[model samples]
Target: MTRKRINVGLIGLGTVGGGVARLLLEQQRRLSDYLGAELTLARAADRDPALAQGLDLPAGVLVADGAAVVADPQVDIVVELIGGLEPARAFVLAAIAGGKHVATANKALLAHHGREIFLAARQKGVGVAFEASVGGGIPLIRSLREGLAANDISHCLGILNGTCNFILSKMTAEGAAYADVLAQAQQEGYAEADPTFDVAGTDTAHKLAIIAALVTGRQPELNDISTEGITKIAPLDIQLAGEFGFKVKLLAVLRKVGQAVELRVHPTLVPLGHPMASVDGPFNALFVEGDWVGEVLLYGRGAGRRPTASAVVGDVLDLARDVLCGCPGRVPPLGSAAEPEGPLALAPLDQTVCKYYFRFAAQDKPGVLAAISAVLAEHRISIEAVIQKGREEAGPVPIVMLTHEANEAAVQRALARINALPFIAEDTMFIRVAG
Candidate 1:
């Protein structure tokens, strides 16, 4: 039996992009069998044409400008691997405008302008797939959009960033400081030359925003999502968190509180017993809570050339099946694009109640403890446990306290007052406790 061939126009033949091409060639038979259609890479676009010169290519397939690939009558679908806003956005919009089905792995581009792009694709009656945008090969977006579609998603919490997770895992296991672990991560190629986006929590926040929008049917305001980096985490704090039966991880959390949704990414202390606590190294894990499923955890390799390429190929195969059936526009861009009304209200950090771990360095003087307790009382914060380590070789003794669920604003105010005291040291560490 002769199989139908679906031509693919690829953009950005970089690391992941090149991998996608290679995977399509290497697994052509398998993918064809799964999709019940043969897939062919008909055209590709690369900023540097020289980069594509050495690759193995099927006859009649070659590098061309992005527009050439998108506008080609022979091209059936456009796969976007370009990783930015301006040209990528323009190229994607142009592809849809030209009536080409699109697939992308650009998270930043999607996070910021998904609504606009999805709307444009819907109007043109073309499908837009982004399975690789969120968690590499995790298939999290599909699980929420299709598998668990029956239930209303209440919340999603996860260790979404691989670089951040690797750094934190090293710090927790070896008791290394942030700079030292980050340096090691860079040397090992787990982190980028400039890892500000990953370390500063912006990267995870972007992923969180995409997931939140998919689950809630609305685009969340980026500025409203609270963000805190792991740069401030100290080795001593990691030790204390472990002693208290918790692991410190940079977590992206999105939950519904009444009609509002709270989205935040920060360094949180997860209970040792929790599923997320065991997710170490460069792995990613997401715990989703749905009305029917209760809680489900998805864990796997978050990022790598092969893992990400696997996801890209999955989308390509799905699109191939649609093309073969003569129903290319059957599925909507985002599965469903009815924009839900109302601004997504974010709960302030303080009002978002959670247990906390506070570490204080104070003078060995007598009444120091009393003063600290008094300040906490003034703010109506109650302590659940206290561990006071003896005087150190340095200026003050280390005093650690675990508090019951309390408003973060009051805790911050109390910490400010304690910082002003003559006995307390300038440095203190506070981490939120998550269960």
Candidate 2:
């Protein structure tokens, strides 16, 4: 019996691209046997051809022009690892136009231009596999699309960015400051030099936008999310949280509130016993809640060359099996045209209501707590717990308070009034408490 050969064309010979080539070449026999087809790395294109030197490939297997690889007649699938909107979008559209399948790990590209790209693939009747886009090798997107298809997912909470998680976890465990841990993470290769995107929650929002579309049938813009970074978190806050039996984590949270969806990213305080709180270091964990499936948690290494490549290879095999069976677009694109409700509205952050952890730095004098309590009461923001650690008589003391469920608008108003007090020394720091 003979097996069909699915020729794969790759763009961007970066870390992930090299891993994909290595895996496809080394695991050819196993993958071919599993898919009932021979998978071939027919060609690859990278801007710097020198990057392909280490990957042992046949002569002329790598080219400088990505479009050439996409336009090749022998290529059946285009694996796009060049992570950006311009050329990657063009390359994916070109592949679909040439009637070829695509697999990509570029979450930013998909988050920004997915509607246009998926629509093109649909019109061309080709499959677009993006299993590597979110949660690295955790198979999160597949779980939402297939495994948990029967249930309507109501809420999704995840520690999406490994860099942010690593920083926060180290701060909690070792009682280190955010800056110190971030510096350590950079030295250890967990964080980049700039580290703005991961620390500022933009990277997590991109992944959240993708997951939100998969679950809610609507894609959200980056501006729609109320994003807060870990830069504002202080070591004193972490200590206060530990005292109250809570842990701090940068969380991406999405909840379906009636017809409107609430999307936000911030440093969240989860109960010490919760699974997300225990997911420390540079690991990712997504907690999805559904009507039928109940609660499901997918946890694993969210990023790295090998783990991300594993996801990309999984997508390759998926596309290969589809090509062999003569079924493209077998699974409808996420947020397809057939969704009856169309786009869902994002609930304004002002309307969001949740418990909160508030830290106020003020003079270690009388009437400070009373004045703060009076303002909170005026705004109807009741306090759940309060802890004030001892401080030297020369400096202001830190007062940490956990509040009951309250509207964000009220919290802001109350905080404003509290900040205006004469004894207050610095701006108040607050973190939302996850339910």
Candidate that scores best on TM-score: 2
RMSD of 1: 1.7
Structural similarity to truth (TM-score) of each candidate: 0.95, 0.98
In terms of lDDT, model 1 sits at 0.85
| Whole-model lDDT per candidate | 0.85, 0.90
lDDT of 2 by residue, 199-264 (tens): 999999989988988887667776788898999998888988999999999999999888779999
Instruction: Work out candidate 2's RMSD over C-alphas.
Output: 1.3
- Backbone clashes, each candidate: 0, 0
The residue-by-residue lDDT of candidate 1 on 228-262, one tens digit each, is: 88999988889988888899999999878786677
Candidate 2 local lDDT, residue 373 = 92
Candidate 1 pairs with clashing backbones: none
